[model samples]
Target chain A: MVTEQQDYAYNSKIEGEVVVSKADAVINWVRSHSVWPMPMGLACCAIELMGVGASKFDIARFGMEVMRFSPRQSDCMIVAGTVTYKMAQAVRRVYDQMAEPKWVVAMGACASTGGMYRSYATLQGVDRILPVDIYVSGCPPRPEALLDGMMRLQDKIKNEKSLYQMKKGREDPDHLPTGPR
Target chain B: MNFEEIFSELKRKEAKDCDSFICEGKDLVNTLEALKAKGYEMLIDLTAIDHGVEASPRFSTIYHLLSLGEKNYLRISVDCEAREEPVVPSVVEVFPAAEWHEREAFDMFGIKFENHPDMRRILMWDEYEHFPLRKDFPLAGIESEYPEQDVVERTDLKVKAAPMAGGPFVADTAGPMSQTEPMAKDQSWTESKPKKEA
Candidate 1:
């Protein structure tokens, strides 16, 4: 579908840049092309996760169709539910089990702050147990919102920081952001 | 019967601090039995709420009773202690729906339903440290991580029955931490030994 001139312009741009390391190129390509997500849907927010998979949203366009149920195989964990005290430890364990370079996205108000259902058993937010890289704020976010979060996570991956470094930066008590999400 | 009649009768019984025929908790059970004697069936949801600020009893239990034959609805409520675990008599034998509703209250409010078949963690995992729904508990997880020494000492955490609240939520049997075996576990960041400064 590319015209001859369009292809030439693309190649010239690539040639003008300094050569990228083979490993870095592969990693860049992989980060964008395939994002294996773990959809940890537990509450009403789970319905939004479903919307992201449906044809209207078509998350498959981003090549993130395969949702790994086992924590070990997943590239990132999307906490899409109301986490309770009973569920916090389990969430942390799953985050731990995920291989290096894993990401976590906290989806919805309930997962972020217990929402209106705040109660004795409801853990206020998931971030206490796992470091949340991106937060999709909504009572339950729209499908596009979830996609936006994933895209932001992709940007985080492009930086090439180890998962531990990224997590520690977020956890640093002194560096907490004062601005709104 | 009209609410006025019930209210007057409750007033006569000298139920202290009684207000406007709002029958709750133990009083609710007694009223339900009296209503059942008059042939009522079907108990609806059992729910509780936490008022968040300190009070003598910072919790309330709500019970809804229905009569299919007569087509009447009655609501009863009781104020009780917001203990780490509040104990209320189970109405499961009286109505099946109460089983799950009580469990839900326990799961969310940390209320304990006495005589319930099971009483354990419902909405949360087994190793979770604090009851989150309590007004005092932060909406977020507790500020500090589980201490390393605490994990080491918990080699004998017991496995209990599933919570009475009947729902899809289940405790991960293979929990994040093994209740029986702690020595073999890796030191998670929450419990990691502090780094040595140069």
Candidate 2:
């Protein structure tokens, strides 16, 4: 729920009127909720990622159920597998292609640090190539864990200073991360 | 999948009667030529084994052949007598499928297949130098660079070795048995440890 102010007093009325709030708060809330994820399922860990999207776990609650294959459409890159050396270039290219105000989630142990494969082929961590905002641990992280990560990302997005907020001469407040819930 | 059991069964039933034999490296082309003349017309698989980097005959090129008409199987083991850079004659001219197989073998074990049309690496990138399957190649890998980063070149995109931290292998031996067995104190391949300049 948005914080109440003099401009937002109409929202409290019966049959609630127009809500007024900072552009940062509104845009961040929208961006956080409807984070269309670019699913980069490279290995076995991707199975767990799929479970998050499916009805059993239901990623729809967080509004990230749209697993966009194309990088252009998606705002979040959930790299859900082992990033091998051969695939590193492709991953980087995809990350670069994605539109700005994008976030990356290194899902599962492999995507975080190569997991059991301490080998020549696998890239040590996806962060070695992509700028990761969140890292979900576990061999294949449970769907709940992924949801938790999504919420954490949402919290991060909520705290970020949007362009409109910056243009309004309002500097980003150095506030400790507050949970969206 | 149970090779020992299958081999034992084959041995009991006289495997030689099936016409599966291990041939020398020099005789590979001749053996394939003769096998093709017979009903064993298909080259099913071609792979290589690394004996050791130092051994006299360090590499062995293995070929599996199959015949639909005769319902027969032939496996040939061609031994190459060389320690470094073992060379085996490519059977691609006779069996077309051997081309990729030979390239894969070269890519993994550094075994050169003579007279193959394209002898470049089949799996790893063209610039990748290491024969990963070689005994000397470490599991944690070697530090290397990726030169193809053209999009956003902010930091130097290098392929760093995985931080093994020597877990499960290197244990804290100074502690009591109970403590030492459960947790590992890094001895080698640690992030905190100072890296040697290349």
Candidate 3:
């Protein structure tokens, strides 16, 4: 019976040495694939976000079905509706409370650009309040569109270099770029 | 009780609907109390309409009261004088549900509900300065003066012109050089001219 270390050595021989592989790549790979999303369902788009979590769309397939309501427990936030002026401050507070290396997906036209409610009460876009990693278009985008957006966020997380820097104590996770591009 | 009996008991002038009445602003609270005593238990809705800036008695707070047992409805229109601050007595004592509706009316039209226990902006944020539904308030929103300004007017924002004059269903009568007089007798559809041999 081969030991676990021997098995890793044998497997690494077929590719590259396991010890020589980039730690950032390994960590990012694991973090990107297992993003726990906080469902911030504000309005109509929330219904579609629910659809993606349900059996039909099965967001669990991508390992993001853990819908945490608390900001502290969530790794990503899916802002799923119109962020009105009344809700902007709350959205910001939630964003601030989320743990570091977090991502925000603005999921729908309203969350991305306040959709048709260009009025006194509605915030033009969630980006005005919180930093957004991905924007899913559509007036309440279909479940598939939300899944696609989540995948895009996963890709962004995979490409992030700051996570490695923070782990190495060379960068401040709290000061990570939370600003709009 | 029937609407007639209630009207006579309340001593309110019966309008055309026989259920609605234009109540004096000062007597609004008492009128609501009397109606509540007469079994108009549910305050269905409380809303205000802002007649344009030029209209007299610029605001009207309309209350829709329903009597479940009697199967009747009453509409009370209370005229709120146009001023820097418009005040109308709160009817929360008569019907507890008026709290939210009155707050909404206050939020939209700036109609002050005097003696409200916890009067504050319900729909808008606490810091929201303007009453949105007022005719004077800009429809899009006012530009913010805060340090982190939220509302930035988009230069690219364009409002599309109406597809047709008046609307799609209405005939275009305002176009330049358009005929305004009735058609000539020969132009009528019934008259037929001889077809030229081709």
Tens-place lDDT digits, model 2, residues A56-148: 999999898898999999989999998888888898888877876789999988899776667778877887667789999877888899999
Candidate 1 per-residue lDDT, tens place, A1-181, comes to 9756544343646577665565655576687568788988889899989889888998898888888899988877899989765565567667667775577889988788555443445655666556678999876898899898888877777766444454776688334321122
Colliding pairs, model 3: none
Alpha-carbon error at A154 in model 2, in Å? 1.7
Model 3 segments more than 4 A misplaced: A1-20, A162-164, A167-174, B1-18, B146-198
Docking class of 1: incorrect
Question: What value does the interface RMSD of model 2 take?
Answer: 8.0
Measured against the true structure, the TM-scores of the candidates, in listed sequence, are: 0.58, 0.77, 0.78
Query: Which portions of model 1 show Cα errors greater than 4 Å?
Result: A1-21, A109-125, A161-181, B1-39, B47-62, B76-88, B104-114, B120-198
- Top candidate (DockQ): 2
- Best-fitting candidate, scored by TM-score: 3
Which lDDT tens digits does candidate 3 get at residues B87-185?
A: 999998888899999999888888899989889989886666778898887554565532223222211222211111111122235555345322232
Worst 10 residues of 3 chain B by lDDT: B159-168
Residue B136 lDDT (model 1): 70
lDDT tens string, model 1, B43-142?
6667887876666567777776677787776566677754455677777776767777887787767788888887666655545566656777643234
Ranking by lDDT: 2, 3, 1
Extract clashing residue pairs from model 2. Answer: none
Interface RMSD of each: 12.8, 8.0, 8.7
